[model samples]
Target: MSTKIKANTDAFIKARVVKGYSQRELARHSGLSHAYVSLLERAIKSVGPSTAKKLSDLLDKELEELFRIEMQPRP
Candidate 1:
């Protein structure tokens, strides 16, 4: 939809695949809902910092490594 929701979708999918996890499995591990994980994979929802941290901890990835969106520059 809106520009294909580009925030490391590919990497997230890859990580999930490498870990042999289904969307439901990842959601369970991350304390998120299965529908929410599906939305993220389909690029229908953006991952916020808290969610990212949860995924990072569950996936054993650094928060920065999970998202590639450029951060706003400090003023």
Candidate 2:
């Protein structure tokens, strides 16, 4: 997978885990399906911009932080 994709996946998983939330719990909080969450974690699907925003809102993080491209520098 590309570095950006890997970074997004890693960030998503790490954020959720750090919050002590399971996939199911994150799905519930984010209003995304558990299967969709699974697909996201596995990098089988790309998360849409709106969905990423929702996840950021749910996780109380900046949307940019969630979907950043690794090693590209952050503003």
Highest lDDT model number: 2
Cα-based RMSD of candidate 2:
6.2
- Candidate 1 local lDDT, 1-75, one digit each (tens): 121122477878888888889999998888889999988877677777677777877777776666655445454
TM-score for all predictions? 0.73, 0.72
lDDT of each: 0.74, 0.75
lDDT per residue as tens, model 2, 16-74: 89888999999998888999889887767666667877888887778877675433445
Report clash pairs, candidate 2. none
Candidate 2: stretches off by over 4 Å: 1-7, 68-75
Clashing residue pairs found in predicted model 1: none
lDDT score, candidate 1: 0.74
Model 2 error, position 51 (Å):
1.1
The most accurate candidate by TM-score is 1
Model 2 lDDT at residue 63 = 80
* Candidate 1 C-alpha error for residue 32, in Å: 1.0
